[model samples]
Each structure stands twice: as C-alpha cells, then as structure tokens.
Target: MAVSNVYYTNMRTTLQENLLQKLERLVRKAGMMDMDFENKFTAIKIHFGEPGNLAYLRPNYSKVLVDLIRSKGGRPFLTDCNTLYVGRRKNALDHLDAAYENGYNPFCTGCHMIIADGLKGTDEVLVPIDGEYVKEAKIGRALMDADIVISLTHFKGHESTGFGGALKNLGMGGGSRAGKMEMHNAGKPFVNQELCVGCGSCKKNCAHGAITIEDRKASIDVNKCVGCGRCIGACPVDAVDSMCDEANDILNKKIAEYTWAVLKDRPHFHVSLVVDVSPNCDCHSENDAAIVPNVGIFASFDPVALDMACVDAVNRQPVINGSYLAEQEHCHHDHFKDTHPDTNWETCIDHGVKLGLGNREYNLITI
Candidate 1:
C-alpha cells in the first residue's frame, strides 16, 4: 500500500494564532488523531538540542503537539536516546539536565522528558535487521516499547548526511549511544597524536578503558574500545574524531533500516520544523548561519515523503546571499545535495520506501 504525506508551512499568524493553530490543523489533516490513544503511551521522538546550540526547535512547538495528543486522550512524552559523541547528553543525568536547560521542562512544553536509553545508556532493545551495514540495531527500550511513535524533527543541513530530516532523526536520533556508533562509523574512535596534550582527560573520562596515552599522546585500543564516544568529547584539542570510513550510501540505507526497526510495527507520525534552516545540524553546540530563510513546519504520515517534500521546497526557494550555499552555482538543484555534494539524501527516502517505512512520492498541500 502507498503511504500519504501532508505538509503545512509556518505562515500562520502567531504561535497562539499561527504555529500552534497550524499544528492542530496539520494533525487533523494528517489524520494522526484518528488512532486510538486512550490511556496509551505515545513517544514523541525529538532532539533536545545540545547545550549552547540555539537553533533547536522552539518549546512552543512542542506544547502545541503535546496539547493535541492530550486532547485525544493520549499521554505524550518528549524522548530521545543518548548521543554517540560525548557532550551534555551522553548520560541520563547530564542528558536530562541538558534537556531541561534547553527549556524542555514540563512547564514549558507541557510534557515530561524521558531519556529513552536509561541512566547508563545501556537500557536498550537489540532489533535484528538485515542490512549492508547493520545486523542489529540498538534502540532505546522505552521507544521500542511505546504504543505509538511520533518524530518531531528540526529539519536542517548535516555535515555527514547532507541533511538531518525525518530519517536521520529516527535512525541516528533514535539509537542508543552505542547504536549511533555502529551506524556512523566502520570501527571504533581514534586519537590524533598531534592534538593530544597528555591531559589524561580522555583516559580518565573513558568508562571503558579503551584509551591509553604513550609519550603524551593518546591511542585507542579498538579491542577495548566500547565505542561509547566519551573520549571524543574529552579531547581538548579535538584530537579524537569519528571514523568516516562507512560508505555514505550504506549509511543512508542503514539509517532507513534502523528507522524501520524503530517504527515498523508501531503507529508512527512525523513532523518537521524547517525554521532556523541552519547549514548544519542542531547537534552542534553552535549552529552555523541559515543557508536559507525559514521555510515552515511540515507533517506527514510518511517520513520519507515529508523529507523529500522539504528538500524540494528548499531547492525552490531563492538562496540567501552570504550563506554557505550562496557561492554554489548549482544551488538550484536538491538543496541538500547542492550543499553536500558527496551525500545523497534521496538514498534514505528510497531505502525507506524499500523498507516499507514510507513513500518518496507525495502531494504537497499548502496550509
């Protein structure tokens, strides 16, 4: 059966009048509220931007969605798994602090924040998937256990994936920290001898004892490395970095497969806010300049269709001067591909379609 995607940009009057009101209308138009929600737990997968990142989706938008879910007799909670790289969100304690600091408090979004991977980032469910890159996907237990899943993605450019849309949000954002490592890298983390200051910070911070220093430089024992990503953040000089040996196409296909694991059997809905329009993901503590002006909010039953529609919409918009994409002559092409020449965002959508996750073809209706 073919899936349908519904879209609505952010052109309404106000948050009270425009954004919030539009969310209600979009949910209805997408028929998301048509599902049975009485006394059921609905997990709203979202990225609570890392601390110092100011480009995250506004808490106001979450309130709109949360209110709508509640009105349908569903209990909704904002949730995200721990990140692969060490930061404010590598563990549940710090992760929750980062979330609350970013104004994801219940008072602000009208929903509690839950770290899906648990305190140590080990509470996970291993889902078997036959894919080129991944055999089993490590997903957060709470998300895997949810009655329904909703992804509220902040659509933007990504240095790795061309763009972080619904697929990236579900595949990368939904994984356990270890799961993210599996999807992002071909192997474990490595240390740059030049950047190591012999600070011992990496070793001390490493919970797995995967790192060791010799002659004031750090080295990673892949055998011992758990791929936890803590040493990556501990290096002051940015010496430790992710291994990019994973093929981009394989990454995209694996992402689709992982997303399938996350939402295959559950009632799933996706929404994306195309504001900020940063040239990189909100995962960065510092967001780069917007490559394009704010597009709008989008909602759909099919994540792939929604993402494809968003890329098309951005490509149609006039490129902003002085942005990262301004100098590119082919800015008229797929906006994400134009910005990231090596990445193919369509791979995710196509693979999603293949995985029975969603459809790539969509009907865009302006609201």
Candidate 2:
C-alpha cells in the first residue's frame, strides 16, 4: 500500500469567513461528501460530550457534515456504543440523556442519537478477525447495520491509547460492553472499597447478580459475573473500574484490529476536530487545559493517516503554558508518547497498516 492522503485547514480565517463557514469549505476540500449516499443508512459515529465535559466537538461542527450528507440523500444518524466502564453512558437510555444534556438534540445538530448497541448494550454483531489479540470483535449492531460509516472525532490525549483520534473513536467507540471488555481486559470490573458506600447500586444494576455488598462494601463474583460492566456505571462514588491487564502495546494492537472490524467493507470516511486539545479522553465528565492551541479540523479516507496528521499538527505548535507541560523540559516531540511512555501509539497505526486498514505515510494536504 502507499501513503494515505490527509487534508487539513488551519483555524485561520479572513474577515468574511467564520469558523462554521470555514468548516463547510474544509469538508468539501477534504472530499467528505464525495461518496454516493442516495437513500443509504449512514451512521455518523461521534462522541456526544459527557454532560459536564466542555471539550467535545460542538454541534455546529457536526451540522456542517450532517447537512452535507443530507444534501447527498443519506439518512444520517449520530451514534456511539455504550461504554465499558460505568458512567452516565453505560446504558442506551442514560447515554441518550447525556447526549441531549450536552446539546446533541435533533434540533441542535439535525441528527438523531442512536446508542449503537441496544438499550441494555447487548445488541452486537460478531466479526471474526485473525489477529494477535482479538479473534472476533463484537461491534454495535446499529453501526454494522449502516450502509456507510463516518466518524467525527475529537482529538485528545488518552491514558490508555496515548491519544484518542479517528481509530480510537471507531475501534473503542464501536464496541458493545462485551466487546469493550474484550479489548480492555479479561472481563472484570473491580470495586474501590474505599469509594464504595455499599449503596447497592451496583448490586441492583448487575443483570447477572455478579455484585454483592457486605460489610458496607461491594465485591464482584467473577464466577457469576457476566462482565456486563453495568455496575461500574451504577456506583455513585466511581468505585468500579475496568481491569487493565493487557500491556499497553498489546492493547493498542487490539484497538487497531477492532477498528479494522468496524470499517472493513463499509463505505467509510473520517473527520477529526483538533480544537480544545484536551489532555485526556472526553470520557471524563470534565476537560482539562488545552495542551496545544486549537488546530483546525482534519479529514481523510484513512484513519491511520488522519491520526498521524493530527499528532504531527500538535507537535508543530508550541506547548501551552500551565497546561500539563509546566515544569517539563525536553518535551522534544511526540507529546502524547511523552505523556504515556509505556504506550506505543504507532504500534496501532503500524498494525492498522498491516491489516490494510490504512497507510501510515500520508500527504498532508491543506484545505
């Protein structure tokens, strides 16, 4: 395979061009709407900000793409899967509520929110893949059911994957609870005994009765546990968390394979917003300081190239003061890698290239 092409546009604008208008122009230049969408069920996979998180892509940015797709005759629906760790977005109902609270209503973005997995996060389609870490990937039924898959992602730092971009958005975001469990660990959520009030919320929400509270604390029985991960979200004190057993490199490779499962055979395109360059996943209800100034949006037919371009763009800009870089020296390059020395973000991209998902080398075309 050859290097993929990634198109970009800086956040600069003339007096006549505002950000929204610039976005429309950029998408066109990036060929975002170049596909034939006539009557197709298009899934616009996006992360609606967790209610309190201020770093998610604004609905206005999405509207640009949504309008473009609509004009091309695609039936577009904004979607994401239920999360693995417990939170407001663990179940479809709660997920939808969080989306609405964050201003992702149809009136706002001109799209509907479909939790990819069913109401309980069980709806999925198993896709077999001969790979190092994953044998089969459990993808959200809604995403798989769509005729076209488009991802609109927020580029940011992640404790696990070094950073979150188009690949992370699809691979991790496309997973059902079980699939997410497969990607993360060996199917278990542990309770932080100190944070547990023994409120029984976990016990109440565990569909498989895997959680039992005793001595004013909660414990999960691995034997009875279905690894549904519902209890993680149910714990008010945030006591429950998914176990992280796989080494960072292995986890990154699994994420790449999962992304391949989601995008393979689908008419797919990607868009990543580099604004509000937060230093962690938007999965957190709150966002931290921007590590870099707001870069513009990027789009590509290749997710690996898109991620690489975003990383390159970030490195080009000087670090923001008082943001996580304070008192840090020799921040030479590869800031995300610097932040997470254990993780090799490139491993995922290299694996992705090997899987024919996309090429790592790319031509950075400015729009």
Candidate 3:
C-alpha cells in the first residue's frame, strides 16, 4: 500500500473565510467531490453529543457536509446507532430527542436525523466478514442501506479505545445493541440484583426465556441467554448491563473487524475534527477541559490514514495546563497513553491495515 493523502486545515480563519468555509475547502481538496453522488443516499455518521457533553462536533460543522452533499444531488441524513449504555441515546425516540435538543434537527442541519437502528435498536443487517474476531457483524440496517457512507467524527480521548476516531465512530457506533455486546464482552450480560426492582421488564423483553424473576430479583440463565443486549436496554432500572470484560486489545481488534463490515463494498469518506480534545468520550454527560489545544480538521478516503494523521497531530501539541493529562504521571511520551495507560489504540489501526482497510502511512496535505 502507498501513503494515503490526508488533507488538513487549521482552525485559524479570516473574516472572509470562516471555519465552516475552511472545512468545505478541506474536504473538497481532500477529493470528497470525486465520488458520484447524484441521487445517492448518503449516510453522514456522527455523534450527536450525549445530551449535555459539549465536546461533540457542532451541528454547524455537520451542516457544511450535509449542504455540500445535497449540492451534489445526494440525499443526506445525519445518523448514528443507539449506544449499548443506558443514556439519552439508547433508544430511537430518546435519541432523536437528544439530537434535536442538541440543535441537530433538520432546521439546523438542513437534513434529518435518523437513529440507524430502529426504535428498539434491533433493526440490523447481518454482514459476514469472517475476520479474526467477528464472523457476522450486526450493523444498523439504515447505515448499511446507504449508497455512500461518510464519517464525521469528533476525535477525542476514549477510556476503552484510548482515542475515538473514524474507525471507532464507524465500527463501534455503527453496531446494533447486540453487535456492541459482541465487541465489549465475550460473555452474556448479568443482572445487578441490587439495582433490579423486579419490574419484569427484562423477563418480558427476553425472547430466549433466559431471564426469570424470583423473590423480587431478576436473574439470567447464561446457558439460554444469547447476549442480544435487549434486556440491558429494556430494564427500567438499568439492572441488566453488559459485562464489558473484553481486554482492550481484543476489543480494539473487534472494532476494526466491525468497521470493515460497515465500509465493505461501499464508497466511504472520513472527516475528523480534532478540536476540544476531551479526556473522555462524548457519551459521558459532561466533558472535562481539553487535553491539548485545538489542532484542526482532517479528511481522507483512507480511514486508517485519517486517524493516524489526527493522532500524530494531537501528540505533537503541548498538553493543556490543569487538564487531566497534565495531572497524570506522564510515564509514556504519548499523551493518549499517559491519559489512558491501559488502552492500546494501535491495535485498531494495525488491525485495520491487516484487513486492507487503508495504509497507516499518510501524506498530510495542508489546505
């Protein structure tokens, strides 16, 4: 593989050309318009910041891409699959409300917001990749149905993956509730008896008859439970939860395979904004101070190269004073490693390379 081209443009803007204009130029320079978008259904995958977390990419940024795609005759819609964790975005109705509350409605974005997975997070398409970890990946049906897939990622620190980039956004974010369970754990979900109110929500939602309520407590029969993660979402009290026991390296590898499943046989493009470099994922309700100063925006046809470039850019910046990274013992020279010692983000990139996703080597072309 050759060195992929990753286009970049700093946040600095003039009165005539603002940040949004710069983004348009960056993506165009990165060759986004090279694709044939006439009458195509384009899924612009993005994280609509988990309600209160202000670290997510603004709807203004997404509108830039949405408007551009529309100009090219593409029918664009902002999308993301429901999360495994209990939050505002765990189900479609709540997820749409969260998006709208965060100013991502069609009025603000010039496009509609669709929870890729259906109301219950079960509307998925089984794609068989036969990778080292995952065989058949369950991705949201709407995401897979798009004629073109574009990732508009908010690059930031993640506790599980070290950093959340294009692959993390597409791979993990594209997975249905069951698919997330497969990536996060090797075993079935267990009930937290203390949290269980015995509302029978889990038992009623279980299709396999693995859940039973006895003595005002719920228990899951592991032998019969298939780990679909429905009970986790169904529990009104959040009693049922994914074990999340997978090692970081294996989790990263599975994420790569899942990414492959999402982007396979599709015309895909990636754009990442390395701003408000938070210490944790946007899934958190609140965001801490940035670990580093705002870097810039990156776009590429190669998701691997795009992430590698953004990571490299972030590592070069000085750590922000009084931020989480500053307080941590900087044993590792890498900021992300110092911030999250146990996570190995390289596993995902290397796995992506092995799976013919894209080249790690990249040529950064400043716009």
Best by lDDT: 3
Better of 2 and 3 by TM-score: 3
lDDT per residue as tens, model 2, 1-367: 8878898888898999988888788778878778999999999999987878999988888888888899999899999998876677978898999998888899988988899998867789999987788888989999999999999999998888889999999998998887888788877878888888888988999888788889999999988987766676566778988887877788888889999999988889998989898878999988889888988889899999999999988878778888884435544477787666666788888888888888878999887
True-structure lDDT of candidate 1: 0.83
The alpha-carbon RMSD values of the candidates against the true structure, listed in the order shown, are 3.1, 2.6, 0.8
- Ranking under TM-score, best-scoring first? 3, 2, 1
TM-score per candidate, in order? 0.88, 0.90, 0.99
User: How would you encode candidate 3's per-residue C-alpha lDDT over 257-340 as one tens digit per residue?
Assistant: 999999999999999999999999999999999999999999999999999999999999999999999999998888899999
- Candidate 3 RMSD to the correct structure: 0.8
Clashes of each: 2, 3, 0
- List, residue by residue over 38-146, the lDDT tens digit for candidate 1: 8789999999998899999878888888888898899999999877665788778889999989988999999899999887666789998876567889899989888
Distance from true location, Cα of 271 in model 2, Å = 0.7
lDDT scores of the candidates, listed in order: 0.83, 0.86, 0.94
lDDT of 1 at 52: 94
Q: Give the range of the ten consecutive residues with the poorest summed lDDT in model 2.
A: 325-334
Task: Tell me which of candidates 1 and 3 scores higher on lDDT.
Answer: 3
